[model samples]
Target: MAVNAHAASARTATARQPRLRIMVLGLRGVIDVQGGIETHARRLYPLLARLGCDVEIVQRSAYYPRERRRRGWRRITLTYLWSPRTRIAETAVHTLLGVLYAAVKRPDVLHLHAIGPALLAPLARLFGLRVVVTHHCADYEREKWGPLAKAVLRAGERLGIAFAHWPIVVSPVLKETVETRYGIDATLIPNGAPMATPRRTRHTLRRFDLQPWRYVLCVARLVPEKRQHDLIAAFQAARPPGWKLVFVGEIEQGDGYCQELIAQAARDATIVLAGYQSGVALHELYTHAGLFVLPSAVEGHPIALLEAAVYEVPLLASAIPANLALPLPRNRYFPVGDAKALARQLEVMTQGTAATTAERRALHAAIRANYSWRKAAELTSSVYRNVARGGWQHG
Candidate 1:
């Protein structure tokens, strides 16, 4: 049977006829380039709009003066003074603004993206608005919080999970955590990446004057948990001839860990600190790299890993369950946080172009066929409609 383009376009047009006005309460700052949640919003927002959902990512006003912000200093002093619940007050202000904005602007469905905004879900419902929340992280107890603070955080997480009309989780791992720990049932919607073109041009690599097929790429935030310093050290110790390591991400203050990474990089010319690259630059780096490595100790199924899979750069990633869940070969994973183990894995991938063209195409097809923003939007729309019809029940 032959299908007509005209009819298909018409069907697509009609299928998206119902416009869903949605306001997404986001954390990691709307413009923060370093966080995964922000990257997810950036990729999904336009697609949501195309799917007939009016999406707005709510952000907070800068808490400090311009000079301090420019110098990599956060307003931690002020935030610390707020004591046991600094984020609550900060997030409440944003949520209040979001709720007020929603009341006036009147979005049909209000979606909250992180734990902070889940604190406002009950109020959003009280104001006669439909609510949705996406849980983006693991148990707060896993974080470095004090005993009293962790207890409060855990309680708050349970409340947020138990009260939302629809709670969407990013992985089966997170789904289990929520169900067992908070007794909240959630639908698992894993992370995805936009289909990327392979880098066939020298233009992108030329910008940094890097040699083609000679550098390994690691794109992530420069945080302790990300274990980027491990990548730096591994690249240094391996010191593979004709191979370099490029780190692409921005660093925050007080973490002061960026300096430590730079010092480690100084011992080897192969390691380049490229800071933050986005849009075309980021895509190009993923496309042109010899291999992509992720040394993260913890992640919620990172989008970078998906991007690497899409571009068919044989990934040498952590041995974490999330990475294991992907269809990559058993040889791709290294024990988490072991630089030497990571170096050994890198040696294997860098040996030669071992992956066949068919394998590359298969991996790309796997990600595109199984995971996409269009499919995400469809599932989300169905969930929203179901919740609107009162089918969704929270714990």
Candidate 2:
């Protein structure tokens, strides 16, 4: 008999509707305040809940006593210890705790996020748990891991891909990488942004005391791989008189990338570093900005870029194919790592062309019409059901 993972099991008549009891694993707890994986899970869970799944979002910290949650700095320290390399020991200490909590809560499927939780897959299988892994980052051989850590993580990724019942990926570049490197078949499900409604009332824009000026907005972690330094150089070279350059998002650990960027901006009145903004402030910034730019050389799929697109803010980004793959038609692209080329693109946007307005509208409509969280949630829910039913097939 043949099986289909895409469809729910018809054999069990008692199964009125597949109760997707999903145990979500990955970057849980405090790390979420900074990373995309955390944000994705937080955004996704409530949508999944509404979709009729019995969902339990598990973080390693859940195993901690209530008293531990109150100690902020100590909690952050413990989280780093819970990183993937240590997850074998970490999971041993906490997976049972995670599972016991799930059992009491009674979940039906297991959906794990991030490469970090892949270390626990072998154990998840031992319990007859169905597994689905969302391959979020590119995790290119060059980027993550030092000499020894790279080799270990590369091997771990291979094992994670092999063991997963089904793998869900965020971009074509990632799906292609997994297929070519690990022979893992993955579903290409792009990331979605919240539908943007610009909050650009006179009061809102005036509250920030900004004049009608064209500015470029760049939102990404201030990390080395993000190539933000290149962006600063490009903005300086472009030298648009009234045009300001603003970068949103926080800096990563040990990297003085943000400080370097600030130093570069010191002489330039046009370049400003607005440290992390969320809620209404973030939305207003995106809405009011003339363009959104991201120069990241490494990405699974950036949520910030997606948010920029949904807002119909004209995008000026690096030429990385994955960044381009997100249905952005009005975008202006520059060669990766080339500050000069990026500067040229910025000049064109600032100069203003007849095509800009039309292109922006078309791109905005395309994103809103196609990329939606509801659709992503529904498709992802199907993957969970497929794995849980033991019907997953390898490509």
Candidate 3:
């Protein structure tokens, strides 16, 4: 049988009996948080709301702040809950609070993103709320986690799949893992990418001291697993003359990883670290890039890569399973962590001859055909609809 990796097309005309209510947990905040899960929620919940599902995403107050709390974006309601800003306690505290809030409000379904927060799936179920968990990635595989944290993450995955009324996996690779290991089949609803408008002006380019179509761009948080250090090494080895390398991600905070990366970028005149940009600034960067690269050692259906593909930028990534899932030429990929191979590809790709108009159209068509917000939301709402029908229940 084919893998359950398909999403429903956004059939806007579908009819429904009294609307379904969904409470979301397990995210920092959808308002420009650094992780891919944030991006997923930012794109998803509004569409869910539009699809006749009553959607409310519970966010950590630390990230949303007092003034921004309880604000609604598009059609979706943003509900803020308290949590410590510390990495370890944040998800646990916020989600525990979110579950209590859900118990009080009593939504029909609770949607949790990522395994960390999904650790509370059993608790959510015990509280008499139908639970749906989206496994964004295998958090245990990340390099930053210590043994205890990794063990906790493994337990999170187990509890999330075992207790959820419906388990959703972001990619087929993850779907297979859940089935092989836990003997549970997951609904595979892939991550969605937005249709972005290209910034027509050169203001952002000039601000970053970058020339149009003369830079290689990589957008990811400066984490070890993301491997921005490896990208920097590869770019230096390539030294694609006249063409600068630009990094677009969070940078102001001085964690050990961020400090090392900031100092490294400072050494190279051609390397630019454009810190924490969104909106038009990010759109413009996508529009004018000569090439886009994602050399991360870890990923789960990257939205950034899809954003680049939407703009028809020449794509290159590490030969990881997630990156390989994208439809790019095989030659576009270098071996994972292989700076020498990446450099060789970079040296040859410096010209950045963009695809023709026909190619650009085809890329947009492919995005519509494959990854779409409307479709993913429709698929997610179907889970809510099923929960309303009172068939699947897990203890």
Compared with the true structure, the alpha-carbon lDDT of candidate 2 equals: 0.67
lDDT of model 3, residue 30 = 82
User: lDDT score, residue 61, model 3?
Assistant: 83
List the global CA lDDT of all models.
Answer: 0.69, 0.67, 0.83
Candidate 1 stretches greater than 4 Å from native: 1-18, 29-32, 63-93, 100-106, 126-128, 139-153
Candidate 2 off by > 4 Å: 1-18, 28-32, 60-106, 141-144, 201-209, 252-254, 265-267, 329-331, 353-355
lDDT of 2 by residue, 1-395 (tens): 12233323332321466556676766555333555786677566666665656655555554444566433331122222232324235544454455444445445666667665565656666666677778888553434246765555565576567777887888888889888987667887677778787785545346544544377888776777788888888888988767788877764435566678777778776677777667777788888888788998877878888888877787877778777777665347778899998888888777865136788788778877766776677667767666666667462
Predicted structure 2, TM vs. truth: 0.81
Task: Judge candidate 2 at residue 190 and give its lDDT.
Answer: 70
Superposed on all Cα atoms, the candidates' RMSDs to the truth, in angstroms, are 6.7, 5.6, 2.4
> In each prediction, how many residue pairs overlap at the backbone (N, C-alpha, C within less than 3 A)?
0, 3, 0
Instruction: Using lDDT, give the best candidate's number.
Output: 3
* Model 3 regions more than 4 Å off: 1-15, 352-364, 393-395
TM-score of 1: 0.83
TM-score of 3: 0.94
Error at 393, model 2, angstroms: 2.7
Error of 1 at 93 (Å): 4.6
